[model samples]
Target: MGNITETKVYMLDTNVFRYKSNPRAHKSYKKATKRFWRNVLQEFRNGESVLYIPKEVIRELEVQSYTLSEKENQRIAQLLELIEETVPDLATPEIEHQIRKITAYVRSEYKSDINAARDMEYGSVSDARILLAAWQYDCIFVTANIKDFMLYPLLFPQNESRLFDLLSENYVIIDPTVYENIHRDPVFAGMLQDLHNMLER
Candidate 1:
């Protein structure tokens, strides 16, 4: 077991939970994803790492769930229940302001980026809220939709140094694919190993 003081914290994006709960997802991939989440929950229960779900993310999921079949909706509800039991929903007064600011800035300034434009058009502003929460908590932000989150720092040239500082301190934005293939991804493997070493110390 890991030391409590050395516990790593993770803030999950909506896509992570959605993909896990997706009924049409391939059986093998679903199995692997469930195994991955089970390990994460076990670690959380052991006080090895913290897991969080932003209120905005939950809102997005809840909105989407209405369109899904009853079975899929139940799956999402169960997943939400598990997450709520594991960690408190994060919210802050600044979150609304931050989301609006991010959406407007990215839409006006980085309009050339199609992904950013589509995210804005599709009302995935949850990304901005989730990012704000991750920044507030200084936790690793994990997501399946990495492009949107990865573009956050690049939008502001003035904050380049601040963004670099966060990256260097290991307050990183990670894609779940990295964890799924840690063996082939040296950077991912190294990060996880470092966390393990910290806990051992």
Candidate 2:
């Protein structure tokens, strides 16, 4: 009812998968993960939706192996099996330029110093890559931490107009707690109905 929603083509963030794999992480996130499988993946496997896991997200997950239990590792492995791995075309000048700007933007926002030594070490570059992958594939970028990605456009309104458009038209940022009751909540219920109609078409 708010806007025409895209039911297919989703690009997932690392945290979305992490919450599912790690049992002790957070109850709400785990519930969101379960609901995502029930609500989204069912349609995805049925050929109604396309799902992508960026290579950068995969790398992030791999690095998290040190803290994960064997069961968590197994869950992550199985989860990866269900997604289509996407390698963002980093060769594009636009993408490279955006990544740099996005990294700097994140540095300023999180570290309060754009030239902080953290640089690529703080996970900004990888986040940029994942977002660009969504843009490249026209996939709805899915994440529980929406603010992390939304900060880019807020800093560079003119240069990131396309991203603004993408955010408005395709971004599917969901709060974990809200997502757990998606069908019961009015706002999310409307979104779900919109997606259902789109998929049926």
**Which numbered prediction scores highest in TM-score against the true structure?**
2
Where is model 1 more than 4 Å wrong at Cα? 1-5, 26-32, 84-124, 151-201
How many clashes show up per model? Answer: 0, 0
What TM-score would every model get versus the actual structure?
A: 0.54, 0.60
Clashing pairs for model 1 are none
| TM-score of model 1 (CA atoms) | 0.54
Residues 1-201 of candidate 1 have per-residue lDDT tens digits of: 854467767777776676678878766556656765787789878878776777777787878877778887777777666553233334343443444444454445444443333343213455656766665566556665544565344322322221211112222222333223333445433543453343345
The predictions' CA RMSDs to the true structure, in order, are 12.5, 13.3
